[model samples]
Target: MSDLRRAAEEWLAQDPDPATRAELRDILDDDQALADRFGARLEFGTAGLRGELGAGPNRMNRVTVMRAAAGLAACLPSGGRVIVGFDARHGSRRFANDTAAVLAGAGLRPEVFADPVPTPVLAHFTRAFDDVVAGVMVTASHNPPRDNGYKVYWADGAQIVPPTDAEISAAIDRVGRVDALLLGAGWLVHDGAGLYLDAVSSLNLGTPDPGLSIVYTPLHGVGRDVLLAAFERAGFAAPAVVPEQAEPDPDFPTVAFPNPEEPGALDLALALAADRGADLVIANDPDADRCAVAVPGPEGWRVLTGDEVGGLLAEHVLRETSGDDRLVVTTIVSSSLLRSIAAAHGVRFAESLTGFKWIMKAGGPPDVAGERGGSSPHRKPDRLVFGYEEALGYSVGDDRGVPVADKDGIGAALAVAALAAEARQGGRTLLDLLDDQARRYGLHATAQLSIRVDDLSLITAAMNRLRAAPPARLGGCAVESFDDLSHGEDGLPPTDGLRFRLAGGSRVVVRPSGTEPKLKCYLEVVLPVDGDIAADRARAAADLDALRADVAATLS
Candidate 1:
């Protein structure tokens, strides 16, 4: 037999699922398919394993999940408790069970959520307990129906970062075949939803005024119950749930991609919002770790960019909460408006590399009492008030330091509802608050130019080309400065990205997508509001459009 055939047969032998065995059997005669499957495994990393589900190591399956669990077991302290949760995705439950089995077999206590839960709930459970060492969430967030993932949250309730991710990957490499690994089950079932809901209830900044009507959708994932429960607990009237997507469906029939950020994903919810005259429309991605908001305007209903939502929420948080040591954090690619928001409120602000892990790991208040999780013991601790990324991920820290170290769409929805209620009661809307921010701080407009490629080498080549000869001008504006982020600047760890600061207070950051096969270029335009929100917004939009085109051309 050929080497590929031999490997395929070997994988089929240990594969627990009869479905995958059949899949591998049929692919054995097809060299291309076999090569795709066995050529490369989905190596675990900071985000853990995520890929199309199939029979091979390259795909997410029982064997792959078990091996990853074993590797995780090796890195954790023996006998430590590990909690496991899953979303309503195909193979999610099985993969989660496999993970629990592996951890239990490795002599650690394993607690499995009895039902499908949102990603944020699992992270909350991971952090709620003092003894829980880490967590595994079986979900791909908003990936396509055919995909699944394994996400690891450390003791801090944040996604595993750097050295830990690297360590787990190395350990996975040493793991033997699944058949050789010991497995155990009958683990304790955890009440993650109940605990998470109560915690989220405490996040509501203000009483939800009855005047603020809202519509919500989970995009056919497992957030409906939790979101509804949270809304009720926060004193908000039950949001009109999109009936078509109210139930969990692994197929995600409503949208091509389950992500709320994708176009048309919110069409059903927006239509419902219109029917109910909802003041706001909220959506959580498949696993509910990200939240997307839509608002009605003179032009009709339009979804707000993550930055717009971030800005509006920041204003509400500042108004509702008090603390001179309060700190907020954002990513290099997110809008810079947050820094201004924090500063204007006499609060501290910090920036971190992309991802909620780094955001949660950000430095804390400079030596103030009552703050729990400020990194940089060397630097005085700053209480983290809030953190967000441009990708619809926000962590709104409550009175008790940051509860969910990772993004909590459920908590954010409550915050959005509370803020929207305040706006409605004050005879304003979310859009008005956004405009008010523009007037106080300069108008900050942001857009993204994402180019997906079939061949991964194209991304590497593009990165190389940009580095060899950086652009001196783009979007009719001179590039004021260029920084190769891979070399590490502004106290950020090394990462593969490029930053271009333009002369007109505009900027662009280009980097490969960490989760998808796309080159993502984040574009931002900053202009002082000229006392007219409409004209200022128009100019900002035009500038961003030109800049986006320039960036696309440069990258191509």
Candidate 2:
């Protein structure tokens, strides 16, 4: 028999789900389908397993989940404790339960959430308990309806990276005989939602005005109850929720993609906001880990970029609280305006490669250690006032209170509401505040050029071409410096990317998407606001368009 057929047969024999067994049998006659199913196993990297929910080892099913759980369990110390939570996605609860059972069978303690919850809750709880060895959040944040994922967090409450992910992958390879694995009922089940909601409520800055009109939507994922409860606890009036999108529906019928960043994803919420005459609109991704905001702009309701939100929140936190050692963090691809804001407030600023895992490890260990299995001791864990990425991920407050080392939509939403209320009291809107910021700090216009390709090699070829022949000028500005991130620079660990600084105070960074098959080029142009702020903004916008076009051509 062929290798693909043999692997399929083996998988079919051990698969407990009758539906998957039938699926494999039906596809056996098609060689391409069989190879697609059994050609290779789904990779469990630092991000853990994420794929379409279907049969075969290449897909996300019970057998794949079981082996992943067993492999993760093998990486922990004996008798260690684990926390498991799931979102309201197809097969999410079952995956969480399967993970708990596998951990329990490995002689470890497993605490499983009774129902669906946000991904940040799992990250918070993982850090709250010292005895907790790790956490498993079963979700596919903002993916299509037919997809599900498994995310692993270590004891420090950050996503797994490097040596740890590799070690766990090795352990998974040693797993044998899915039928021989044990499944039982000794694990503990608890209401993680309550704990998470209570923690989210504590992030309230102050008593918000009772009459602030707001609109919110979870986009058919599980965030409505917790977000509403948080609003009430923070002393704000109940928001006018998008009735159709309030409930948690795994199918996510309303939107083509569940991510708030996607175009038209927030149309329903915007309509509700317009009808209610609301002050602002807040939206969370399907798993409620990333927050997006929309406000009434001159040209209708416009959603703010992740960089704008990051800058605003950084300013809010700095203004509300005062400390000598306060710090702010963002990714390299994010707008440089944050550095100016941080400097004006005397807050230290830092930049990471691209992900929250590196941003959260700020002031921690310099490199990944094999045996310790967690972040190096933070020099001042309490000093992390705020951290964010261009992908709408924010970590706010001190570790002792919030304990969230990952992106948090609930906490960010609460902060946005409070800021809006304060702005209203001063006879100003969010757009007004943004205008003031642009005047004080130069107008920083940013754009992204993302090219998606069916063949993965296209991305590799583009990167190689850029590296071999670096552009001399971009958008009529001469290139001043070129730094290849692969060899490491400016105290950052080596990563696969390139950064170019233009003579006219513009910048560009090219890198591959960590999760998608796309090559993204981030462009920014900083124009000084000399006279009319509007004219400066217009000029900056035009300059950004030219820069984007030039960069796109260079990549082509």
Candidate 3:
């Protein structure tokens, strides 16, 4: 704590920026806030730094940003090209430009996007530039307005993984202060958003019904115009904008959390759906890399979980492809329904860590096309044919055959609405089709329990409590086996998580979110159905209830 305090003081003393100095003043005056904001140096883990925006060593300020950029530049191999992108956040655009300047000063060529763009577009562009060894995106995704992030991607257009993260972090540690370096002019800026839109347009293999009433909200981020343009270029109807969230607002006033997966983040979009009787509601986080969706349900409007949407989209992508060596990908934290769905279609299924970066790696090159040739970076199996996480990220195609491995929320939204239209033509709802999927490939029910903590130590304590004493039983079923993810028992690298297997193919996974101060418990219960759909649904629902109670009892 003293070392951290000293570091904060040193930066505070020299910070010329008025805003940084003001934030530093606040930190010095408020002991608790100081403890919270400067308790530790902001972590630059496997995914790099993301935290509340403020002016402390532990916050997302100019000092930390410059230090990180310098470290990244120093860590990169000599002669490597670096690409940068930013979202619509408080200091996102400035941070991005500053990072490029820092990189250029370090003698590395920095290719920066001209304006605020989605993280996924940066993901795609990372691979487009030859000799590019690393990529950086300034975004906080769905976090509160006061939060910002620096997501580092590797040369492969995927977020930095494993040894590279440690390597980069070590480089960052070597930098004593933010003022130690002088930056040079960055390379000529590129039209990253235009390229991203062009790529998405080329991946329109599925026929979208132009008549379907679609509503879209960028959730006050950078994706509104690009997404709308892509929809139109793909021969799909232009989406109705949720007037309140149509324009980019760093404050994100309508929602507490900008993530669409959150219960009420899509309230405005859902309300719009209710008012227009729109066929579907589509929402993207501030940067537009992740998408949130809503479908008109029997009870007002129902928001679909990321897994349900992924599984449904996976099925759609497979149906559109003709590859014999088809592979569908998702993260382990996501629902296992995709596995069963993939198996039924004779397609291979692969699981990675809970990030689109991992899924994109499993799918292959970010810029390569899938079965069909396209220039966008979102193509599925053929390139990155289809990949998603429970956190609402979906990348449709690749850039070479398609272009980049970036997630295309706009493309995914169009695909979902199109699929719903096809279902409507068949006299069925998406839920009805999902029921059919369940009946064909056993009923799959998945749920997540997330526990938020105010302190870092509390988070560690919760994980320690779980590991020191494993659960004997859950949902009335005996705990068959348990695996500590930290030990890498699942043929994957060690991660801070735990997985428990039940007696009847049921599973529970407990892990702290890498980017958020929360513990997440994922539950998957399978219901075998030979002839009964109603009974299967009832059994799955009951299983979820029991599992929820068991988790609550254990965690609480």
For this target, which candidate reaches the highest TM-score against the unseen true structure? 1
lDDT sort, best first: 1, 2, 3
Tens-digit lDDT track of model 1 for 1-556 = 8888999999988999999999998878999999999998998889899999998889999999999999999999998999999999999988888999899999999999989999999999998899999999999999999999999999988999989999999999999989998988789998648888878888748777866788999999999999988877778788888999999999999898899988899999999998888789999998999999999999889899999999888877777778776778889999989878876887777778899999988764343432223546465457777899999999886656567889989889989988888888889988888888889999999999999999999999999999999888888899999999999977678999999999868899999999999999999999998888899899989998899988899888
Better of 2 and 3 by lDDT: 2
| Each candidate's clash count | 9, 0, 29
Candidate 2's displacement at residue 257, Å, is 0.8
Q: Note the Cα lDDT for every prediction shown.
A: 0.89, 0.85, 0.78
lDDT for model 1 comes to: 0.89
Candidate No. with top lDDT: 1
Candidate 3 residues lying further than 4 Å off, grouped into runs, are: 1-6, 26-34, 363-384, 398-403, 530-535
Q: Could you tell me every candidate's TM-score relative to the true structure?
A: 0.97, 0.95, 0.91
Kindly report which residue stretches of model 1 are placed more than 4 angstroms away from their true locations once superposed: 364-380
By TM-score: ranked, best first = 1, 2, 3
Error of 2 at 410 (Å): 0.4
Candidate 2 accuracy as lDDT: 0.85
Clashing pairs in 1: 364-381, 364-382, 365-381, 365-382, 365-383, 366-380, 366-381, 367-380, 367-381
Candidate 3 local distance difference test against the native: 0.78
Is 1 or 3 the stronger prediction by lDDT?
Answer: 1
**Per-residue C-alpha lDDT of model 2 across residues 289-344, encoded as one tens digit per residue:** 99999999788998998888888888887887676567677888999888889879
